[model samples]
Target: MGDSASRSRVSYPVFQDVNHMVIFGFGFFLTFLKRYGFSSTGFNLLIIVLGVQCSVLIEDLLIFLLQREDENSLKRITNAVVSMTAVVISTGALLGKTNPVQLILMTVVEIIVFHMSRWINETFLQVPDNLSMTHVHLFGAYFGLAVSSRFSEPLPRSEKNASTPKSDLLSMLGTLFLWVFWPSFNSVLAVDKSKAIYNTYFALAVSAVTAFLLSVLTTKDGKFRMTHIQSAVLAGGVTVGYAGHGIKYPWIAMILGLLASVISILGSYCLQRCLNPALKIHDSSGVHFTFGLPGVLGALAQVVLTVINNWTNSARQGHLVTVHIGAFCLTVSVALITGFITGLILNLKLFKTIPVSKYFEDQLYWEFPHLAVGF
Candidate 1:
């Protein structure tokens, strides 16, 4: 009963779109590493497979513990897919610096924490973020950064960390897939599904344009970086995540998208250089800019919209704003503490961590052809 029946009816097709984003979109998106293609795509597949199964089990266990009725099959699958997404985003930040065993272990720990945080946001705080503003994107990004910070050795500059022309092309393919499917992703649980879709589409289109323009302008040579194109172009979707379901105007989505693109592209151009040395965080795929900051922007946008909608009632406005901010703070705190602990566990000698010398090379895990011509 309730919203579950209706959610189930429309869930599958959108689920397929989101699943595509997880599989092909994310899989290839991380393939920008020239020598780490196999690890990038292969590790992503392994994590998603493990994450989905674990997430479903954890969600079901939690529901039973809470004495709540079970979600329908479709809804459960949808939630599992979404749960895996946070792990995938976190993986992006830790890519090339982690071994397969370490990644598998991290996936399990992160999924457990993610589901618990999600439950708290939904049950205790009644967070209204349909697109997982704080619970997924923000938490995933910061958690990965936190884990990366635990490494004693910084990610060294090496040829293997650089992308080849072919790898960049593959990464762009992933970006296009995400750009095309993101509207379906944002609208899956929206109250006004059509409006969510429309707003998300508008936001993405604008963000893409802004990313391209800035990439050229920001560089001394006035050339576009494949990194910016691959990552920054998608910030619009993250920025509009919480707002997509309720925003009443196309202009609002466009403005949010524009701001998100600027922040993401600028972070990559400026912040990425100093962030590692300054904070001891080595972000492999710039997740902090692409997901973290845009997520914060989206969360704030949602709070502003909540205020606007309840302007006539000061008491109601204050309560809703408090809930929104409280949820964000809780999600950040839980993710950082849990992620830091997980990092400490992974740092122990027993985990068989990746060596600094083998950071971004697929040869450590994958076999290659004698020539391996294009790769």
Candidate 2:
């Protein structure tokens, strides 16, 4: 009756925004694949389920053990959404590579590692980041990429992960869902009348457009690639997450969006044409461009904005610089090492797993009941 009566609940609309983003946004986003629609959406559903269940338990238990308190229902739900989002980002890099059961197991190990990293940085590293670009986005991308590199099998060049008219249309539904609600997604945590939210909303719109235009312009023959457009348009949200609270100007948001969109398109090109093969990593959803590098850009933006805002605070500046560096090193090292170990454990073959050749297609897992096959 003491603190319970006085505690404020998260706004209903904010919770709803994050909810839709996770469900419709992430699910449909993966459906862009031409052949792997079944596996793509199905696997996403699986991981979300698995990740949610395990995330609650792991997070709550850690809270009890470490903080010596029990979490309330609302907090658990909110944190569960955040945890699932991180898992979903990680899954993008390993899409079509693992079966339902394998992905479930991976979720278990991943939640453990994910929470551990978040806790260490928050509790010990004292990093000025909560859902910071480095913590949530980059951490998942690098972790998934590491796992993909170690154990993921590549889709053959002859294989089709390309988009069909219907598939592409469906994919856009996912994009639209994500794009429409993105402002809410970014601004939900901010105070009312927050510059962060304002900047975030505008930045999202600008990036989406810039990403679309740049995607068309940057292709080898100047033709638009769906992958680039899909991945890069979201970079705006990532960039503005840096200092949305302090960034009072829309032009700055535009500039950041423009730059992030360019980098995202370029990241897609290089990752697809060059890095994937040379690095021996099979990134199924091209998450590096979409979520990974943009997040890094966000981290950079954080530094730039901090400097521009408070250039005269020498001692505070020194402390922030040190914390940022430490945070980066900690996030990268833990993500890579922990992800590699998780992949190894996933490779143990205790479970009956699907062959790598059957990676992307839907028949291996989901049942499609309605299509009439011809002789």
Candidate 3:
């Protein structure tokens, strides 16, 4: 028993140490890239890519935490909490200037836009049958970044599925490293470095706290389940895109955070039913697209609202409505065309090698032994 205990203790710290090393390496690489004359635009683009990747990684972490128990869950929880706490504490200590009001307002705007987009997608646009708001948001963020960076299509589903324990572990390391440098990414070109630093740190703190509390409260069977926290964090982050430029109200951010969380929960519940009449898919291994109609509509709704906002903002700034409309139309057209081309490209070659028959056979053999022969 003593030996076992010693081994257990050593294992966790070793895992943590490895995680730190990976993070350090990644940070050094990014720093080196910056020092080697990488453009400011390149740095911004890197942040956007890394941020979306981190978002996906965080989602995976939540799922892992939920699926694990005892020491595994505890270890995951400790890592998440400690990493976030370190970010918040260090930011507070290092950069103490921030606008609380602007922060709050930005948070609220983000939450509202996020939920509104989900609502719109659920109500209209038949894109797919099983897409969730979270998925849609992720797609939008990734899609947006891809457009901004002029990259090829996003990572394929097969590649994502092939992710293993080691890769996932590396992803967590990546997430923490991103968290540490988020302020720079968010505010790199800002005239007010002080405010940018403060806002970025504050948002990170809120996201971490919100994620932790939600994990604890919403988890079932020792697994970290999805909750309103996901939406809240995304909404808060997106809101920063706009609100960060305006007022920095913490209360507004908190209110937005709460609203986003509630709306995400309610919207997901309602849309899950509407879009998934057969309810064949489970959220256990990630949302399946076979039942993703409502999710498509949700995505459309978000697109519409964003269009309207852009139009209004541009008009207010005395730009031609045609320009705004043209821009929106161009963006949508490009996204659709690019997404299609990329999806096709990715589906070629080895992507087609994932034998569906084999997968189904394995599922029958292992997941439903009693029903494998149609008992």
**Top candidate by lDDT:** 1
Tens digit of per-residue lDDT, candidate 1, span 1-375 = 867778666677899998999899999999998888998899999999999999889878887888978767986777788778889999998889888889999999999898778778887888753644335888998888888788765446676778889999998999899899999888776778899999999999999999999999988899988888887789999889877878888999999999999999887756666866788777888899989999989889989999999999999999999988988888888888998998999988998888887888888888887758885
lDDT for 326 in candidate 1 is: 86
TM-scores of all predicted structures: 0.94, 0.90, 0.39
**Best TM-score among the predictions, by candidate number:** 1
| Model 1: colliding residue pairs | none
Lowest lDDT sum, 10 consecutive residues, model 1, at 127-136
lDDT of 3 by residue, 1-375 (tens): 787667567546544543443244232222211111121112223333343344335535535765723344334433332222211211111111112222122222222333333334434433221222223323332222222222122223422223334434443443455555545433433445466556546655665566556556555655553333323333333333223323355554444334333344445556457743343222211112111222233333334444555665754433333332333343334433543343343334543323322221123112445655766
State candidate 3's TM-score: 0.39
- Against the reference, the lDDT scores of all candidates come to 0.86, 0.74, 0.35
Ranking of models by TM-score? 1, 2, 3
**Model 2, residue 247: C-alpha shift (Å):** 1.9
